[model samples]
Target: MEVLSLIAGGVTTAVQPINLMLIVLGVTVGLFIGAMPGLGSVNGVAILLPVTFLVPPTSAIIFLAAIYYGAMYGGAISSVALGIPGASTAVATTFDGRPLALQGRASLALVTAALASFVGGTVATVFFSLFAPLLAEVALSFGPPEIFALMLLAFATFVGLGGDDIPKTIFSICFGLVLATVGFDTISGEPRLVLFDIQGFLRGIGFIVLAIGVYGIGEMLWTIEQTRGDVTTTNPKMTVKGLISDSKEAVRRGWKGTWIGSVLGFFVGVLPAAGATPGSLMAYGVAKMTSRTPEEYGKGSPDGVAAPEAANNSASTGSMLPMLTLGIPGSPTTAILLGGMVMWGLTPGPRLFIDESEFVWGLIGSFYISNVAAVVINLAFIPLFVWMLRMPFTILAPLIFVLSIIGGFAASRSMHDLWLIVIFGISAFFMRKFDYPLAPAVLAIVLGPIAEPTLRQSLLLSSGDPTIFFTRPIAAPIMVIALILIFLPALKLLRRKRQVTQD
Candidate 1:
């Protein structure tokens, strides 16, 4: 009955005209951002944060979150049709999505991605509506120790579960932490790496700048470097046969991917730093491991394509849990939204539930409607979206480059920010050449600023007692969880390497 009542309350709050309009607006912007190369969800939301200054916090948050959800859908279109991942979370989709497009199933791939995302998003939202308060209760029991543990666990998962080499992953993460430490000694209020007072560097490298550079510029350069001869184009004519062929398989194969993705996405979403990329990749791995045709994973397996689509989409929803309850963002995109929330004078911690129950529940409720709306909107237009890929990259790339610059400048209204964009872009291109993962670096940039300060504050409050992190019952458990998460992935990596050598 309590759960039922909460649902009712959420529906009442979210069904208003203003909130509904915001959802539509966010979905539109999100789709455009997602459709474009080099403009991902994080960049999209970061660009929009300033606009929130003029709106109510409730509207602003709802709008930003909606854009993220919509972008998830848009990313699939790009991957399936254009052979370019619209977002990092959608990278897994490229393995099969692009193949399906080459086979003239582009429309079907888009439809599957859209539908899978909808299923994943809807399931997660419903779970959130019923389970948020319970999750909050669990979160409340956590202390500094537990939180630190959880973060450690989150970082470990990235290294262990990321589908690349463990040593490189570790190096990437350590590199991120080091980069994160460059701005200032948060403990002593002294600059550490500024090295002669460059004002822009004093703030450390901005996450958006880094992301646009490595992901956007680096990716663009990589694509150009690998530029092949004119490839035969696949025309995905929107046909009944295509619809039937795809829908039948989706209905048959989607259930497993949907459930697996939703669960993985939800769990990872709860972890502060893991976010949708890991969740989607993990889901794809799990789906492959459990599939009847496991060998078909990288060869355009529909299930392979379906799993990450569902996982990343569900992960996006899962990320909202911490954002609403603890004021901690589960992903970088959410971190951008966090800034918007703070700017609107709305603090995002637990008190938000009580003082802004309507807003909280309303935002949660809007997710349900918007996710469903995305399926309807994107699926109906999959043909058009897929057709967009026929446009030459030469034409598309310039526009995306422009958007990346605009989005970066829009973030702070500063030309310095724009220059920083170019710097990061070049850096990202070089990092790509070295095969370093940019996600960890970006994660560090986003979470480090918050985590480092919290660590120092907790320790100081306890008079520098090292055990203070472990002494807090809640914090200790969370820390323990983090340790387990980190170690398990490392162990798995070792076992896999041994197995490969033995084989």
Candidate 2:
């Protein structure tokens, strides 16, 4: 009851004209930035963090929080419209979002993403308000071994992202893992796989580079080759009735995934370093894994679109809990927010709730408001986004090319990355032609950096005994489940072979 009273008071604080105005402004700015390739919530929050200084600290965090919330929603827009994930968090969204777009169901995909995001954000905020302190302790429980086990679980779930070709999926994941190891050794800090002694390899391959190359350029190439310049998506109608129907269909089809992602994403996001990207990916994998119609997952399934969209937004909210209560940032954006809090003469930790109750509650209250604001603003812009889809293939191909090149360069400002993007793009086109799933590769590169360090740290903690993963109370179950998931596809494949032989 006391917490409810605080939340009510916090809501009142967030409703003040200044805060509400900032909420809308921040969400709008974030929406567009997140829609841009190579830019995500980190870029949006960092770019505008300077502006927050002019306001009071409470208002500043709310503004940045609004942008963070909006960006989560915005990230799905590019995934659906351009076939490129607007943020790493949205990579799973592309698994179905892009397919929906190609099928002229972009409207349905966008609507599902928006609704799922709202639901997920609302659910995570409720969790945040109810169990902030307890969850922070749970986050603290994750040591290197536990974290590595969790990463193992993530890789196991990753198989769900690929086609039924088990060996091909394994190959794709291995390829990605190798690419993930191209940079310096996580502990030794020495270059390990610098091909041709290129100094740029030290920087390693950015996920955005691979994502843009594979989804953006490679998709473009595949489209041109397939259609031979005769591609056209149905011009989506954006009337009020159309939106209502899409909303209903989204709920009918995607509700299960929305709930799954909201719960799972929040849980994952509550971990100290596990952020929205993995949360979204894992959510997508689970949704597909659990579906009776698993084969429908990558082919414009509304549930598939909903899972990742919901998870990313929920995880973004859940990430704030550790930052507010434990002085640990659950995500990259929250890390910046933590820094901003310190700059404003406030400390995050056990005392934060008692000493800075108003600030903490105000931010949480703003989460409720910003979710409403983002969905409403995003819905209003649906027509504009869909309009882009109507463009002829000739015009759209060049646009994709320019955005891919610009996004790669802007993220790192490296000519080497630029060249790699081009090379990867062409390579992706070939991979596509061969029917190898690129999703596993993308997931690997994203998780590899995090996985490598934790695995190495876990091994060191156990004196190089691999049994550490199976001995720790928390790690053991996760490792067991991960191992099962890794073998599940192969088991199914072998069973099918046996049946065929008997026939």
Candidate 3:
């Protein structure tokens, strides 16, 4: 009854003409931002955040949240059409999305991505609305030790599930952790790995700069090397009837992937620093693991595209729980939203629901509304986006290059970051050449800083006793789970070796 009343109130608040207009406008802007290579929800939200100051608090947050949702859908567009992910979360989507596009199934891929994203976002939003208080209570119970354990679990899961080459994945994660440690220490004000000669070293490398460099510039370089001639373009006229037919077929084919992704993405999103990238990657891994036709995954499998698209969108919604309940941002984008909330004089936490019940429920309602709007907009414009692929690679490549440079520089407005992009771009080219999975490294970079601080805090609380992690009730079980995840692969390897010796 309470949930129903809140929903009713939210519907009333959100249906206002001005509020509805803002949702439409926000989704439109997000779609544009997400379609551009190297720009994702983080950039989209950051770029538009200042504009929200001019609007009402509810309106501003609603707009930003819509952008976040719409951008997730937009990220899929480029991944399928151009074999380039618009965001890190969309990287897994490219595995099968690009293949499907190449096989003249771009329409099917795009529709599946849109529909799956809608399903994921809607389901996650429902969970967010109904179970948020219960989940928030669980989240509030976690201290520094528990938080650290959770972060470790996220890292272990990603690394273990990421790829076939365990050693390479481990190396990639270590490399990222090293990069994350270069900046000033969170505990002390001292910088540990700063190159004294360069002032920018004090700031450390920006994740956005690295992401744009590696995924955007690196992809461009790889594409240039692989292209023999003009890129092949397919223009399939998808009628409404055909689209409806294909959507039903896609849902039938991808329901399992969609459900798995939605559940995983939601839970992962609730954990601090565990964002859509890991959620999507884990979803794709699970989809592949459970697939009867696993060999078709990296080919043109529809489930591959559906799984990650669903997971990323669902995770985007899940990341909001901490921000609203505990005043802790679950992801980078939510961190920005947290800042926006503070700037708007609205404090985020349990009081947020009590004091600003209207805003809270209204934002929840907007998720359902905006998700439906995004799917409709993406479906309606599929033909135009597909037509965009007709441009020559020679033309598209340089454009992507320029956009990547601009996006990198925009990340921090530092020339040094641009230089870092060039350096990392070159490095990523080689990494790709060596077949190293970049996703694990990227995940490490995001989680390392959070994990380090939490670990230190936990230690300080326990007088430097490392056993604190294993002694706490919540943290202990979580750490045990992480251990199981980490050791499972090693156990498999050892068993294989023993079998070989016995033979």
Candidate 4:
């Protein structure tokens, strides 16, 4: 009943003209950005975040959140029409999507993707609305020690489960933690990492600057380096009649895959630092495993495209759980959202529901509106989006650079931040070259500050006894989980090495 009332109040708030317009605009822009190769939800949200500075907090969040969902829908376009995935989350879609396109069934593939995305997003949003408040209520019992333990768990999970290269992930996270310590100490007024005679260093690096540089500018640079010539897409002639017919076929054939993706994606997304990429990949694997025609998975199977599309979209919604409730971001895109919330002077956590009910509920309400809007907009504007794909990278690359520079400068109106963007962008390019994950670094930057303060407070509360983290009943279990996550990978590596030696 309480959840229903909040949902009702949210609906009432979201229907306002200004908010509704923002939602449409956000989805449109997000679709365009997401359709462009190398630009996904992270880049879409980061680049546009500065533009939202002039709007009200609730409206800004609603707009950004809309873009996030819209991009998930748009990513399927490139994956199906071309072999290239528009977003990392959509990579799994290409296995079957491109094959279907090659087989002249692009319309069926696209329709399936769109419909599955809508189902996944809507179901996940409903789950978010129902579960977030309960999670937040439970989180209210967490003190500083528990919060610290949770942050450790987040870092551990990402490092352990992110990729096969644990060392690179650890290095990325440690680098971010070091970056987090560069500015003034929150407990004390002392500046820590300020270089001599550099005024901007005192203000520290803005999250927006880092986000735009690493995701937007860095991505553009990589795209420029890799892309050789004008890319053309398979333009399948899609009519309204064909679309309606294909939609029915997709639902009939892909319903099981959709359900599998949605359930797995939502649960994985709820885990801190576990983003959409794994969820989508896992869903695709599950679909293939269960399919009677498993041999068709990589050869234009509709179920192949449906599963990943459904999972990625659902996971996108799921990633919002920790960000909204515990103030921990599950993905880089959510990290940007968390940063935006902070910039708007809104503190995320259990208290957010009580203190800013309107903002929280309003944002939640906008999710439903945006999910439906994304499908309609994507279907209606497919031609235009395909045209957008034909735009030269030479022209698009410079435009991205300009926007990234503008966003960096807009953060604090500082030239220093622009320079920082350039530095970070270059660093990110090199990191990408070495196969180091940027998400962990970004996550660490967001969580590092929070972890430091929480740890300090816990120590103070326990009268300098560090065992406080393990003494509390709730904190103890969480810490144990964290420790297990941290060591499991190392243990695996050790056993592998020992087996090789024996062999």
Candidate 5:
């Protein structure tokens, strides 16, 4: 009943002409960013943050969130049409999406991705509307110990969920933790990681630079490796008949994937560091293991495309959980929003719901509107998007690279960011070849900073008693849940190995 009222109020606020227009505008821009390789939600939102200064806070946030979802839909197109994933979370989409495109079913792949995204996002958004307030209440009651435990859980979940080389993922996460230390020591006011002259480094590596490097530059390198083959030239014509066939196919193959992605995405999004990549990868892996036609995977199976796309989109909603409830960002893009929220003098977290009910609910309502708009827009634009494929990558590459540099520098107007973009571009290229996941790295960087401070505060308050983390009821249970989540994957892998050995 409480949730229904909030939803009612949210709809009312969202229905205002100005807000409605913003939703359409936000989705339109987000779609373009998602199509443009290497841009990602983090870079896209960061680039647009300055524009928000001239707009209302709620409107600005609504616009940025719309972009985030739009890009998600756009990424499917890139993966299916160009064989290049627009973001790390879409990596799994490449497994089957590109294959379908290669087989002259690109339109089917795109339509399926968009529709699945819509369903996953819509379901997750409804769940979010109902659950966020309840979760916020729980979060508001949390003390430092509980917060610390939750942060630990987030860290563990990401490390465990990431299917990449575990050691490298750990190294990247730890590197982020180190980078987090570059700023002032929260307790001592001491400059720890700064090499004595650069105050900007004292602010730590900006999220914008990291995103552009890992996503933008890294994407460029990945694209460069693929010998420019005859770009999936055949148009898999999408007609009303084709649409019906694809929708039926989506329902047939995507039901489980949708649920898996939605549920997993919700849990991961609640964690401060888990983010979308883990959700997408885990969904893909689970779908493959569960499928009756496992052999068809990675060879144009619609289920393969459906699963990851669902997970990635669902995870985008999930990523909002911690951001809204605990004031901790579950992803880099959320972190950027956190900064924007602070700048707007509006605190995020449990209190926001109580004090800014309309704003909070309006944002939630916009998710539904933007998602519907995304499907309608993409369906109409499929032919145009397909036509973009015929344009040469050689021309697109430099344009993308230049935009990345601009977006990076634009984040804070620091020239150092330009250098960071170049360096990250090189690093992202290598990481791609090495099979590393940048999402985990970025999530770690963003949340690691918040976690470390919380941990320190908890420890100090407890007089260095680590048991305080487990003694608190709410915090302890969350920690335990996280522990189970972390160990379950490993246990499953071990069981599979044992079964193989016995066979």
Candidate 6:
């Protein structure tokens, strides 16, 4: 009942004139951004984060959350129309969405995606409202040792479940941690790792600088390379009666997968480093594996399209759970949001619910508003987005390039950051080319500062006894689990090798 009242208050706050306006505007911008191939919520948020400085922190977060919600809905548009995923999280959507388009059911696939997304997001938000406060209460008891153990668990998830090259992922994380140590020593108050004695290094490498470089400029470059070949799109036409029939058909065929994804996605997404992409893929696999007609999945089935589309949106909302309650990011996009919160002079974790009660609840409230706005706007504007896809990437690339530069400059007002953006962009291109996962690196940089302090504090409290991490009641099981997850891949590899030897 107490939680419900706070949520009601949040909804009241979100419906204020300026807040509502920003929600609609943010959703509109995000819809277009997500419909473009290679541009996802992460890119849209990173490139536009500096612009949020114009608004109050509460409204700024609302706007960004709306963009995130809208992006999840829009990614399916490209999958249905162009036979290509608008973002990596939507890749599963393409399996059935493209087939549906090829069979002239593109409008149906898209409508199903929109409807499933709505259901998934609303369900996840209800779960969030119910569970977040309880989690926050548990987190309030945490001290340095417990917090450090949680941080270890967070990185461990990347090693166990990141679905990337293990060596390269470790390397990326180490590189980001090294960067996080550059500016100064927090405890000692001394200059540290100032490369080449460059004055700019004293300020540290900002996460925003790296994020914009990787997602904004580097991703744009990668897309240009990928799209060198001509893309043939399916022409989808929708009418009022057609939409009505498609909606009914979508509900009848996709209801099961929608429920499955809404539940499954939220749990997966709450695990740090296991964001929407894996959640969607997992949902698709589960939905097909359990289906009566499994063979129908890859052949224009509405269930197939609905499962992934719903899971991705559900996971996007789910990713916010840890970020709000525990100060850990559950996804790459949330990592960036975490940094933005710190930049705004706000701390995450349980105390944030106390220190910034209005800000916290208001952002939570905007989730409902954003989800509803995203579905309505998405359904109404499908034809418009499909038409916009006809616009050339050759033209879009230059605009993103300019925006990335401007955003990079806007954050620090530094020529130094601009050069760093170019360097990181080129570096990110090579990293992606070599199949290195960048999310772990981004996450490491964001968590490194917080993790380092807690580790040092824990060590001091224990008189240099590393066993303190395992001795605490709350930290012990978490530490044990983290160690197991970290070594899981290596254990699997060794078992495989021994089996091969016996064979």
Which candidate leads in lDDT? 2
| Tens-place lDDT digits, model 2, residues 1-503 | 99999999889889999999999999999999899999888998898888889999999999999999989999999999998997789999988998888888889999999999999999999999999898888889889888778777887786644565777778888888889999788788888899899999999888888888898888889888998977766555778899899999999999989999999999999988888888998898889888889899888999999999899999999889888888899878899999999999999999999999999999989999999999999998887888888998788879888988898889989999989988888999998898888877887888888888998888888899999999989999988988888887778779999999999
Error of 5 at 339 (Å): 10
Computed on alpha carbons, the lDDT of every model, listed in order, comes to: 0.72, 0.89, 0.82, 0.78, 0.74, 0.79
lDDT of 3 at 353: 90
Which residue pairs of candidate 5 clash? Answer: 269-318
lDDT per residue as tens, model 1, 297-330: 6556777778888888888887888887888887
The TM-score between candidate 1 and the true structure equals 0.72
318-373 per-residue lDDT for model 6 (tens digits): 88988987898867678888888888889998789889989988998999999889
Residues 115-226, model 3: lDDT tens digits: 8899999999999999997887776777789878877776676555544477887888888888888878877888878866588988887566766777677766865676
Q: How high is each candidate's TM-score?
A: 0.72, 0.97, 0.89, 0.62, 0.70, 0.62
Clashing pairs in 4: none
TM-score, candidate number 2: 0.97
- TM-score of model 5 (CA atoms): 0.70
Across 1-503, the per-residue lDDT of candidate 5 in tens digits comes to: 97888888787777678878877877888888887655677777898999888878888888888889988888787677665566667767877887787676777788778877888798788878878766545435666666567556656655655455677777777876676677688779987787557766766676556766775677557756764433334664556787678778877766776777777666555555556766676676667667787778768888778777887888788778778777888788899988998999998877888898878888888888888888898787777766554456666566657766765665558776677668877987888788776655665565566678778888888899887777887778877876876676679889999999999
Off by over 4 Å in 5: 1-22, 33-109, 128-132, 141-164, 183-189, 195-200, 226-245, 264-367, 428-439, 467-503
Evaluate residue 466 in candidate 1 and report its C-alpha lDDT on the 0 to 100 scale. Answer: 71
Candidate 1 weakest lDDT stretch, 10 residues: 228-237
After superposing candidate 4, which stretches have Cα over 4 Å from the reference? 135-237, 383-503
- Angstrom error of the Cα, residue 344, model 5: value is 11
Kindly report which residue pairs in candidate 6 clash with one another. none
Model 5, residue 54: distance off in Å is 11
